[model samples]
Target: MKERVQKALDGIADLVWPRICAVGACSRAVDRPGRHICSGCYSTLPFYAPGGACRICGAPVAAKVSHLFTCETCTAAPPCYERTCSVLAYEGVAEELVKAFKYNRATWLAEDFAELAEGAVRAELDSHSVDVVVPVPLHPNRQRQRGYNQSALVARSLARRLNRRMDESSLVRIRDTPKQSLLGGSERRKNLKGAFSVVRPAFVRGRAILLLDDVTTTGSTLAAAAEPLRAAGAAHIWCATIARAASTS
Candidate 1:
């Protein structure tokens, strides 16, 4: 009875106060009345093809080789994480939505973002192997200022959808590093070299970690965070992000 009542309340709330959708104004017609984004918009969002993508980094590649589409950079120097996935190209409305979530504290869009990510992850990976979900953590000060970690919200939603354990406290950001967006790749790597540490190593040991984040440009931050988990004996680390910046190099 309580569950039914709660469902009724939720339905009433949706009817009374619909959430602001994420589809752009031009695409508003594509959205359903109370949803975050319309099915059409969701369909139109850019998706990286699973084929001809780097086996390790998951970046798009021109051709496949040796049962993997290895990006040139990954071929030269590999990232720490075993695999990575992204939903959209980091531009236009996608970029704006990410900025709003991370800096403006527009957490209402998290569910929509998670839905998009979940689809991409399922398409790219076999879900049965995933054991835990971990969000990239922010330093305490930044987290307080922002009112929440956007990554954590996404991670929680993903955990619920996948019916997997969430280990938010397993990994932590011990150092406050300068923002990497403005820096070059080398500097970004330097900025994040020692920024992350695992708090409860036992929680992640022998488990496959599904790491969530908002975006990836140089991938320094994700790699840095993965280092600690890798050191703690994580079996496999797979990263998922909302978008990826197009690399000029």
Candidate 2:
């Protein structure tokens, strides 16, 4: 049949062609099987130093506090989320990865981001026994415009990897706020006030929740999103992002 011939052609074409790296701006072929990024590009991606990161925001701590000390901003005014873990500093190839995943609708990159997030959050997850995995919700308008929620994609992958329940219905965004990156920190917080609410309080009430996102600029959005979860009697809130814009210590 014609269908069988087409299938055979497709398979032969795949075997003959080299797989290109998925990281945008990289032209290299994938170096390893079952991977999208070439090893060379992967090595170039910015990574956090892994030690002495702030427990509150995952920012690099100047002095080695071993997770005991707080960063200037976090100590001055703590966020609703109890812990934070960002696997990479948002620069270089990491920034490219974020843009590709977030703007280019690269859903496969979600799997890579999830793997990075798992390495960071595994220690906490093992100790805390997370009850649920929640992705920061996008406004209905934005979701419709994009045809999918990036956070939901990353969170769904994360939950599956963690073997925890993923709940998209429990949290809802009531307002379609302006992009967080366009405003100052204060403006970002104000822009997000009353923007999120819990429609299904029963799901989060008294449960430890892990929040996932691709990149965090100021973390104002995450803090705002956690307010509703806190009010709903969630016992703990933790955040894990693919990258943070701040410099590593």
36-134: candidate 2 lDDT, tens digit per residue: 678888777788665686768777766666537677899898989998878888888788777877788777677677777777789554424788899
Error of 1 at 245 (Å): 1.3
- Clash count in backbone of candidate 1: 0
Give all candidate RMSDs, comma-separated. Answer: 2.6, 4.7
lDDT of 1 by residue, 165-240 (tens): 8888989999998887778888888889889999899998999999988888767788999999999999999999
Superposed model 1: Cα runs more than 4 Å off: 1-7, 18-20, 24-34, 49-51, 62-67
Which residue pairs show backbone clashes in model 1? none
lDDT of each: 0.81, 0.81
